[model samples]
Target: MRLTGLPLILLAGALTIATVVATVRWWRRLPIRIAGLLVMEVLLVLEAGLIANRMARFYPSWQALGGTPEVAVVAATTAGRLDASIAAGEAIPWTPPGSGSWGLATTPLVVVPPDYLTCPDRRFPVVIVLTGVTPRPAEGVLSVVLAPTARTNAASLATVPAALSADFRVTDTYAVVAGPGPAQPGLHALRSFDEAVRELPPPLTAPHRLPS
Candidate 1:
């Protein structure tokens, strides 16, 4: 689910107001109100600190979050190219140049092709993991992405091998691109990529020609 910046900001504002109201309501009834407020403030501060830490740690990718919108290509590469697809919200197929076969990952993995001008020989499969806007206590969108495919129903772009191995069979080779919205957590996205790679089928033994 893609979440725009406006909704996130609004949600934050609402939460802040709710916290304030709750704090004020209990202030008159108990002496612990002071302690409660102090604790709440401390917790809020800590939460802010943690968010800051994550922002800094994920700066490279996070910076690309709301900036110039471009196609974020994530790809994977094996000795031989295998057919694959991404499932962020929908499945999109990708076939890298120069390979016998290719397969997509289980999650929404993108393919970053080698630049024809510079690194023409570079071909790698990539997975683009998107994060959601909603900041809640429960599991974040990133976490959901990284969660086991067997557990969640979010978008999943995976290779045929990975898909066949999965509880459900994927029917295409493409990247799953999700719109900007509330996501679980980015870590889940990474995890999904890793899982897809790990679960992909081993390379074929003989060369096979594509159907013309």
Candidate 2:
């Protein structure tokens, strides 16, 4: 079964309750009681951990816990296939190579500046736009509209620029803009603004911790 959802939490709770009832019913037998108590404790801990995961979303999926390929590597290898019809300054549907680990249900979108076609040697800075709903790309800048919680995670955010660099001519420097959502957190050294379009080369600051 998939992890980190209401169903999993309910299953864990049910198992814990069953263990507790079994322990009480078998109290007459010393060995059974001891084993039941031990199982109950374990189940209780498991239930709590599951609940916490549901609330905090530490491990969205089994693959995320085991760790997937780095975003840079995946982007370099798999993100090379671009449709012939794709044009500059237009939003392109992107799977975002390493997004499997983030458990994204929808594909992310990327918008490169119109000059990106003519300016072959020029590497443009990137802007990460985080939104809870569908995103509308801005003009002139390389915009990456991320699905909610697609590594808005500061620890994982650093790898994104590197990933984009593999396929697109983008610089290491990037700025983040958080739209309305629960995924709001300090994105590594990158500070998030309500709207930061056309603001080239934002200042880098100390990393901030995200809630676990």
Candidate 3:
């Protein structure tokens, strides 16, 4: 099973429980804390091995981060939004300003405000979508989740559908190596989301860090 985010905390809690059970005597015999730790450590090592083995497989052959391949133009009906007030232009190719970068582009996703044209001044909601470890953005989020919801709801929404580099893939993938500085590639994935939002220009950019 994937051990990420909250699960790690849960593991710590489980280990704590095991530790308590070992320390706190029940009746006569000492709890198996030492033995439990040894077993748990062994299990942890095995788990690490299994995780490492699985994560090694995520280095997909396709380019990540920078460039995207050509795919059939999603029908205006089926594909993501073509042009919205939130978008800088009609789904411009997402190429960062600098040359030195990681990852290749995968899909043609658009990032737009919920109501850019209608509510130019109002700060609406922004959704920075990071498609799971897969190469392309999950169409379901853009098509199934957001589209239907956006049509019905008036909350100005900005979604990053498609257009993310494979570098952003974190789930079931390698760990984020937080280098000394924020410039690290591993950390760039999320910061890049902020950068993308900054590109929105004018009013749409205000909600870069949306409120709680």
Q: List runs of model 3 lying over 4 Å from the truth.
A: 1-92, 99-102, 123-125, 132-212
> Which one is best on TM-score?
2
The local lDDT score (0 to 100) that residue 88 gets in candidate 2 is 73
Residues 7-51 of candidate 3 have per-residue lDDT tens digits of 554575577566556555532444465666666666666456444
TM-score of 2: 0.47
Where is model 1 more than 4 Å wrong at Cα? 1-4, 31-212
Candidate 1 per-residue lDDT, tens place, 1-212, comes to: 11323444355456656666777888786765776677667667645644564456433344545575544443332222232332222222332232113222233322222221122222222233333221121110111122133222242322333433231212222222233343433323333334444433322222233434
lDDT for each residue of candidate 2 in 1-212, tens digit (9 for 90 to 100): 87887887788888888888888988899998999989988888888888888788898898888986544321222222342345777887776568555544467778766766655545566777765343454444577777755444766555677678677766666777765445455652233433455466532222333434
Give per-model TM-scores. Answer: 0.20, 0.47, 0.21
How far does residue 6 in candidate 3 sit from its true spot (Å)?
Answer: 57
How accurate locally is residue 146 in candidate 1, as Cα lDDT from 0 to 100? 20
In candidate 3, position 74 carries an lDDT of 25
